[model samples]
Target: MKGIAFDALVDLFPGLGGWHYVPVPTEVRDAIGGHTTRGLIPVRAAIGTTAWDTSLQPMGDGSHFIALKAAVRRAEGITVGDRVTVTVSRR
Candidate 1:
């Protein structure tokens, strides 16, 4: 599958036990497929040279986000609040 690439700001989800993520743009979500009523959508994602197979989680507000694992962030030298370019494709 072709990957959709976009720039996003890494952010921390407040009051959710410190979940870090990058919000998937609506266009990118639409490109991969539309919003899910429930459950996560499997995906392959890359940030620079770091890549991982994860899932796109619905935010329950008609949007989606990809959780940024601590190891991935460490490998990419990124932290919350950093802007990043992410490439994602359906798995």
Candidate 2:
């Protein structure tokens, strides 16, 4: 699966600080339905030549996406707007 990286603003409970993430778009999720598990999807994410293990998250509305860790982003020299390719399969 492939997607354009973008910053996702996360809003937690009241008084809690929000966070940001780079998400996998809905089309990518649709491309890997067989890998979904209880709304969470495990994936091997890569940008350019950098890769890492991570999981995809579901929005409250049922759309699913993934977050790129800061380390991965820094190592890959990627930020929001960068394009990434992700691989999902049974372990």
| Cα lDDT listed for each candidate | 0.89, 0.55
Q: Per-prediction TM-score, please?
A: 0.89, 0.58
CA deviation > 4 Å runs, candidate 2: 1-19, 34-38, 81-91
- Prediction 1 global C-alpha lDDT: 0.89
Error of 2 at 60 (Å): 1.2
Lowest lDDT sum, 10 consecutive residues, model 1, at 30-39
Residue-wise C-alpha lDDT for candidate 2, range 1-91, written one tens digit per residue: 3533433432232355433345455656666553343477766665556767777777666566566666766776655555555445322
RMSDs, each prediction?
A: 1.9, 5.2
* Top candidate when judged by lDDT against the true structure: 1
Task: Give the CA lDDT, 0 to 100, for residue 64 in model 1.
Answer: 90
Tens-digit lDDT string for candidate 1 (3-90): 9999999999889578899999888877887556457889999999999999988888878999999989999999888999999998
